[model samples]
Target: MYIILFNLLSWVTFFVFLFVLYLLILWMWGNMTAKVPFVGVPSKVLHEIEKALDINDDSVVYDLGCGDGKVLFYLYKKNPKATYIGIENSSFPTILAKTRNWWHKKFNTSKIEIIKKDFFEVDLSNATHIFTYLYPSLMDDLLPKLDKELKSGTKLVSASFHFTTKKEIKEIDLKRGRYQLTNKIYVYEF
Candidate 1:
């Protein structure tokens, strides 16, 4: 029994070490290749946006820089009939998000896609709703592209970063209740 316990402990330690190493490599690669690190939207902020948007079943949702597809999954859970597209540039998070999409495809059987490419390269013309948690500089660059691609009346929800465009319709601020940190989600109609 002691020997079996020792073997199990050794295996657990080895896997933990490997997982840590994998995360370190992903961090290095993300810093080198992508402009921003993989940061997820806080749950409170996500809920606030979901409540505000009241996404319909037929809406097409695009999540730019969708790290691990948390936002997509949340939205999917809320309304499985809606189509979700996650565009992730980084390799590791994209792989994880694809794996998640596969699992969802096998189980929930929804229209969800995870593409490992730059968000800028994808066309947003058909999107009925768009979501992003990008930095201010990237947001500035993306505003023109969104304006040119998305049709009029498309809704956009930006978390933590505000665009300079005059299209903003609503803003909701929520406190995380820790770290004295507060986040804001901006809603815009184009």
Candidate 2:
């Protein structure tokens, strides 16, 4: 009986080790390789976000996570006078955002900036429109900051995850994931 118990404990420990490795892999990939936990904002959602917020050519838009800075880049393509800011915590994403911003500022007709830092550390009060693709867990840390930092009538957009407190201005299904409806954008006003 003791031997059997030992074997069971060993197996449990081994599985826990594997699970931890998996989580580490996810974090590293999200921060470096971006294999998972990093997905671009879908075009459908971007369209709706811009439309819902009534984004103008001169709007100051801030994209949290800003993976590859596609959302901000595309928005700049549409409106050249708009100021785009990207907050990316991961090295790979931040580097990519920097490269993109450099090229666009080099030749393109607009100015875009990328900052390497966690979204929670940045100030969003002056942001006319804010975009994020982060999960609900991040929301737990961000809601209070949002409540305190953002001004009245500022637009907040999230892809796939929902915050518990804010009133969602719109919800639409343009894509479906394996276990959930994906193309969902939640817009909030503060």
lDDT of each: 0.86, 0.77
Backbone clash total, candidate 1: 1
Clashes of each: 1, 0
Pairs with backbone N, CA or C atoms under 3 Å apart (clashes), candidate 2: none
| Over 4 Å off, model 1 | 1-23, 177-182
Error of 2 at 168 (Å): 1.0
Tens digits of per-residue lDDT for model 2, 77-182: 7777888899887766676679778877778766788998878788888888888788787875788998898888788878778887666877755566756535
Which residue pairs come into collision in candidate 1?
Answer: 153-190
* Ten residues in sequence with the least summed lDDT for candidate 2: 30-39
lDDT of 1 at 12: 100
* Candidate 1, 1-190: lDDT as tens digits: 9999999999999999999899789868896877878878877666787876678988999999999999999989989999999999997888789988888788878888999889899999999999988888999899889889999989988887888755579888675555633367788898
What is the Cα-based TM-score of model 2? 0.76
